[model samples]
Target: MNANMRAAAPTEVLRYTAFSADPDGGNPAGVVLDASALDDAARLAVAAEVGYSETAFLTPAPQGTEGAPEGRAFTTRYFSPLAEVAFCGHATIATAVALGERIGPGELLFLTPAGPIPVTVVGGDGESGPRATLSSVEPHSEPVEDKDLTEALAALGWARGDLDPEIPPRIAFGGNDHLVLAVTSRERLGALDYDFERLKELMLRLGLTTLQLVWRESAGVFHVRDPFPVGGVREDPATGAAAAAFGGYARELGIVPEESRFTLHQGEDMGRPGELTVDLRAGDPRVHVSGTAARIG
Candidate 1:
């Protein structure tokens, strides 16, 4: 693999862990703070070398691309180890927090292929570390056909009875697309052995970012696992994009109140436990996901 980042401008790659205060507890992402001169190939090479599920490339907003001021707003792109993706939440959070440390905590706009995203960074007090919250694009969910659900279950090695009847399968979109599958029990959710190639083919055909496997723990707490085959990763420790999509799915399906807040526990099965806070407002269709990030050496 060509794993090299070469360009004229400064191309420092910052490493950080998103969705947890501990460096080893959350999803790790590579953040390129200034990638103005890097081409797509160079960015991809850098991401491959970083060996993270996703790496974010940031540059100043180009002229006439959007109304964003040159230095204030950024044009961002996300690349996995294999290819580029429309959006990636964990990397976005890591990038936001990295920018926050340099520019001070505030709001920053990122122009992504999915759309314009608004991210707010808050400085941490003595009690907590720096955190970032991203508001997703208008989210929507569509019913999943029986055939698709059946095929997905087969790839996941799960039977129909293992699924949670209350939360039906659906395709949810919050910046990126995700297949939301709710399991009946935590045990069922924990045993995740899937046909990677088969699932990757299905996801590629359907343009899905990840399979959001979930189990509702209580009224507001849930456990989630994301199988990201297309990204060249077996599983994502903490998936903020999937969490946002799942929040939208839960709200639209009436599983939760229109205006509600929920907690998602993820990566525990993988030993990198993370906590993501999801919020859904009554009037707004967008989903908000919040998590802390820490720099990693």
Candidate 2:
């Protein structure tokens, strides 16, 4: 059998919601604990069947994949219903918490396409579930080209005047590229009606993972929405990757001070209502995102 199609039997896939203790809230991800025997095709098939925004597949370290040890480390890959993503923050958090439940919480390393991501999972108390914090790869943001920005705004059904003059448009990267567009009011952020296919086309052309639609509620609080047409999801309830990227953007823009921590409210409009915490250290460039997750099924 071709390696990509070789599979002995069906593997167990766990369902978990990331960034929320309540099973009905947060972003749901399908977790395959042992995918060593499955090939790319099989993984894709599994993700499609699960029908989550993203599904995480964990396999023993493959040749050329390095980090930690045999049992302590794994090569993790994320797949959406339609395609594979370089990294997925919510899925990573969910996977870590799931592993913590089985192996006892501590530190877990993932060898991902983006790079090695270090995740720390805290064991859950009886009442509340486990929480995981994942430190992103070094983050960076750059000015969005005027033409690209214009195209994005048009696709979002937004005009240049609709944006917050303070938070200029930028392309930010934590693990994946996200176009960060900050609006002047929460009303604007909540009223999200866009040209889906047009936005998807532009995102695919620019290699964007999601459009980070944001509104600043206060100095330390914000509301965020992610448009993830590229991933075959209209919107993600809670997006850890975009949160990290936005944290980097805010710090770089001096909108928030260094060594700052903030709360992000997401999925409110969709009724999922998940919360994510983002932290930045004085000197460290990488962003940290923390949230709690629970098993759904």
Write candidate 2's Cα lDDT for 1-297 as tens digits. 776995568789999999999998999999999998888998999999999999999987655545574466888999999999999999999999999999988888888899889899997777768899999998889988999999999998898888998888899999999999999989999999888899999999999999999899899999999999998899999999999999998998898998999999999999898999999999898899999999996
- List candidate 2 segments past 4 Å from native: 1-7, 62-70
Q: Provide the overall lDDT of each model, using Cα atoms, as 2-decimal numbers.
A: 0.92, 0.92
Error of 1 at 81 (Å): 0.6
**Count: clashes, candidate 1:** 0
lDDT of 2 at 107: 82
- lDDT (10s digit) by residue, model 1, range 1-297: 356855455568999999998888889999998888789999999999999999999988777655564455898999999999999999999999999899888888899999998899999975557899999998899988889888999999999999899999999999889999999999999999999999999999899999999999999899999999999999999999998898888898899999999999999999999999999988998899999998997
Candidate 2 lowest-lDDT run of ten? 61-70
lDDT of 1 at 230: 98
